[model samples]
Target: MSVSPSSPVRNPWIVLACAATIVTIAMGIRQSSGLFLRPIELELGVGREAFGLAIAVQNLILGLAQPFIGALADRHGAGRVAAAGAAVYALGLILASQSATALGLNLTLGFLVGLAMTGVTFVVVIGAAARAVPPEKRGLAAGIVTAGGSFGQFLLVPLAQGLIGSFGWRETFLIFAALAAAIAVLAIGIAGRPRQQAGISTQSFGEALREASGHSGFWLLNGGFFVCGFHVAFIGTHLPAFLADRGLDPAVGARALALIGLFNIIGSYLFGLSADRFRKKYVLSGIYFGRAAIMALFLSVPFSPLSATLFAAAMGFLWLGTVPLTSGLVGQIFGVRYLSTLFGIVFLFHQLGAFFGAWAAGLAYEATGSYDLAWTASIALALMAGLLNWPIRDAPVARLSMEGAR
Candidate 1:
């Protein structure tokens, strides 16, 4: 028997590969931004609070733009939007390299890069990949695309460190700008065909938004995801400084982040598989609970290089594991027609949490000369997030159910 010319099985892998690679470039560069914080602040003679505020703005803009970008992807094409994002992102990097003040950095890195990321990152790349694959394979496909980000983190963090060390932060940004521009060329592979609006009238965008707004489970998912953003952004942005405060070598922080990235590859894939086989809400709850437990253990133990390494390994495994389950749940409850937009709405909450996490950590440390308060808040939020996911009803929405009945 020959396969049909239009079968997803025939070309799904190719699309997945392209989506994953595009995600790798976008996420790797974003993740490595933390490594430049110290160097940039020192060179520019700015306080940590100012730099952290800039990153906070970036996260805020990324979240705010997600819904619009996702809508654009749903209407136009993921490839075009992502390619355009890459061009803007590269421009932001180039301009950021020349920025001498916090305000300039806020415009270039905070607003432009953040806005560009909405197109190049999950909402566009993962959403396109999820649409390209069969329903059963979406969990795995989302996982693979997300893992690409982890792989980038593992690969690029060290490379970024080397670049910053060898040349300078300005020169490093230039090199990264070139890489970002290259992503525009690579994005063509995952563009897929244009949207076809024939047989799929389950819900209009307004209807879908209204339905999601009325659903308690949807709010629960958003709440849980908010905690995820807070934890991830805070740690990713501040871990290096935290480690330095603990008297560990700078290399230890880099190594720790690398370990997290490496283990995240395993965790993302496994959780993706788990979501396919188990209750997605339960899986998400477990991830959040596990994060809380791991953080508690790390805090209880004495601070040392060995302890820090162990913390990194444990935290890395749980780092991005929430993404697959959260996204899968969104697609599961609502159909894929509006997946990008719905998920983008949820992501806005996540970014809001991230803004506070990144900015507040800096403020707390600056005021108190310690990260102890941030650590406590993360643990509390993790526990709260776990509780939030526990009660989320993961059943299909009424619209999908009605469509299925018909």
Candidate 2:
């Protein structure tokens, strides 16, 4: 439970602060990109499907690169990896500002931004933050860090909307590019050697992979997380457009997104505390089930600004609430040594679902001119995810268990 004298971070709070700041910048900018969809499409005279595909590509690349990026963080240090990612992220935004074609957008926004995100986002930040704290406090620590992203969402979405309304999307991109550069400086605070657990065996990276691969719970966790990606990506990417399609003001969508982010701060922190007290799988199941119910209600009711805000608030409370619990479960079962790599593998599945969610929603809207199919699909997937988590055995792995017994 004690940090070694040689550890770079003598205080866990410093690590949390640095990781939270990095996420605040990286995720804030990334999540707000959806607000640019209509502006970019209108300016370039491109179709929604094309722009959506670009975002979809971004999500796919982000997911695909996570495992490798996470492994790099595991092998090297999170601070350096995250700092490098910040540079890539900033460069990507700058390049994206000048993109005039779908291919250019795809490369800069999708591939480059996504690659940068792999280092700065949850897999690296949360994993590193979790390692800095004691085992008992990992869930709450992860929750506090995950809430940083929600705080970004709350703060940035509205700001991005206003900036786009005034300065144009390209100018806004330039502004965000500058902010991305700041994340590199914050990464230095979290940079350090991995903390060593007292009793856990020193498993090789390959050995850790083999252990996770053989565990049924690991796959179940991945399955449940897939739904998380779908819900968040679809809503984040399309909600503004969806509101506009319903004849609502565009500001309504931005406000709704901000509300979701605001409430998610509370949800993430509370759920993280809950995970420390209850079974993590049960907490995850409850979150997925809540998402299904909330989505269904949002659809069945008449469309109004009030309804949208209410839905946003309700959904926000459930949003990102799963993150700390899911990551905590991984640490509980697998120990924290290779957490970045293992969680990255699980996150890849989440991103795969994200790819489908963002891309398919666009495709469906373009074809049918409605998001009915995507909404219904999300509801069904939420239920499925809830079921998937219910049966997971929330226990320490054999190595950790044996070590504890000794």
Candidate 3:
């Protein structure tokens, strides 16, 4: 039901806060995974590739499942899906702790974890936030939600590192499991029946895909987001290792990643506000271009504590900046009716890129004994993404809107 314009329920800040909290807690757990890698490898006697493959699988599976979860949220209620996801996510972590073999780990942490992630992450969180806020505020809401993930990275990574230092990695997983379980409570605040107006315009899952697939702008948006996945997943998963390789202490890399998370809060909020005031597509295009420029500068300059810190600051600003614009565009083109499902499909592409991004960095480093190639490819992708987004037509697609009523 539509709240009358004057109702307090329509207050944008209230909606933004709810979205931000959900994203923050969910993302915080996901960010802590990097802290587990070395410990799991040491305990299990698995090669880096084995662990890497599991993470890649997780990204791939999460991407694939996102659309389904998003569709369910759009069709039913985000609250129910999120609550279910929290349960599964907690269970997945608990299962991971029990897995004694490589295959078990793969299934538990890899596939099941990915499945759990879909319910809690951007797909569901952003969908609810979108419907809660007005059209003009959607971009800002998306940014706030995305920033919550960054906030998670900032707040949880250090906590994970401390946990690893104090307790064993296996126990860490157990603790994380408990935290995931707690999200079920938060889900209550986010859950409810979909507003009647939002449901009435939702298309079937297949129809939303067909509509998105047919749009050139959607393709460009997808392709650009692919680069975003590449940049973020690569750096998030492997930057610590790179810092260690450059002779900085391991703690330095961890701190740097934490800094990225902390600083990204500012970046995400600023980018979101900019999207609200300006044309979203252009804002996204500029952010991509900025990434390309920053990556180039970072690679050209000699690596050092100062340079690395500066690079992290610059990149953090661009990190997840696409979220506000990309998600906002989905709502703009399709309306909020089927947004979760449609955006989840788009996120699948993003995850596909993330799988490669995270997986490829490991492979590239092992093969070349350096991460230069991966870094270069990231820069090129950013440039290509900037170009591709430049031409996207952001006006509503009327045919799809009509078809959504069926």
Candidate 4:
């Protein structure tokens, strides 16, 4: 297979670096959103479910917008889309800080931020990075970009915590808004549309969707990622509160979330390497099973700050390892022509899982004053996801195989 070099304008290293930076700033601030739950509930006189609902709505909007936005990225390019998204993301954060009611937050944070994220987050950025590299390099390239998000989580979560400590959650958000705006400048570095190298104009987005829909493996991939979304959203949003419910310092949860970010850098990179060397499907299956095992251990073990920290480290290593592998698999099997659009559909399923995960956790805590039921659901889903990924027919689609032959 003779893969062509990227366009002269799209420097692989530069695009990957920009993609990483974008993911860092975007995901870092977004993931820390969970940290504001307690303070927001107190100041706004809203319940946990209210705040959770807002975040839940954000995830839903993100999922709903991905395919259309992804198709646009596929056709046009990510530069303008990402820049506009950065602008909106910054504006949303600024407005969210000024919000006086939960409904106001729902509009600013939930709706606006959710829409902006589709532009700056993995789907758009990963598509750009994938286009900048050859097929063999896609897995590790995706990993490198995903690791950037972990780095942000490591650094920014703690930074947000400190800022909230000294100033307030609203002030912290204003600061993050400034950080969000920076992505627009970086978007220039990643500019370039992906041309179809495999076969020119052989497939349309509708045909791509139709082909994938007929493939059992694609649906299985979606089912597995659904569990991944559930685990990530549930744990990331609720872990700090769960730890606090057991009589620990609020800072402990913050540190734990940071630790997850720190270790995930190594994990995502390693898993990226693993995907290039091993079967992505088996590796994905292992990751899901490992998550289930670790969460089960967390539940059975006695509660302590040390235990929470360890759990964070363990889960963090597994945190986003799925992103590179999942996206990589999509490219490996389907080809990268409409990689962003196809993966966007997969990500929609992921966000659906996230929506349910975030909302259900709040409902569980409100009704039972504990997250035990949510945790159980996460564990069961993880196990189920493990099985779902195991049987995927990990091979290139017929068209890709024919293209490779050419």
What's the TM for model 2?
0.97
Clashing pairs in 1: none
List residue ranges in candidate 3 displaced over 4 A: 1-15, 198-207, 399-406
Query: For candidate 1, lDDT tens digit of each residue in 177-262?
Result: 99999888878777754353345454677988988889999999899989998998899889988998889888888888888888
Model 3's lDDT to the true fold?
0.81
Per-residue lDDT of candidate 3, residues 91-191 (tens digit):
98999988887798789888998999898888888888777776677777788899998898899888888888899887888998998888788777666
Error of 1 at 48 (Å): 1.2
The CA lDDT at 15 in model 4 is 86
What digit string (tens of lDDT, one per residue) describes model 4 on residues 13-82?
A: 8888899999999999988988998899889898888888888888889988998899998988988889
Could you tell me the lDDT of residue 228 within candidate 3? 86
List CA RMSD, all candidates. 2.1, 1.5, 3.0, 1.6
Q: Please give the range of 10 consecutive residues that has the lowest summed lDDT in model 2.
A: 1-10
The superposed Cα distance between candidate 3 and the true structure at residue 120, in angstroms, equals 0.5
Q: In lDDT terms, how accurate is model 1?
A: 0.86
List TM-score per model, in order. Answer: 0.96, 0.97, 0.92, 0.97
Q: Report lDDT (CA) for all predictions.
A: 0.86, 0.90, 0.81, 0.90
- State in Å the error of residue 367, model 4: 1.0
- What overall lDDT, based on C-alpha atoms, would model 4 receive against the true structure? 0.90
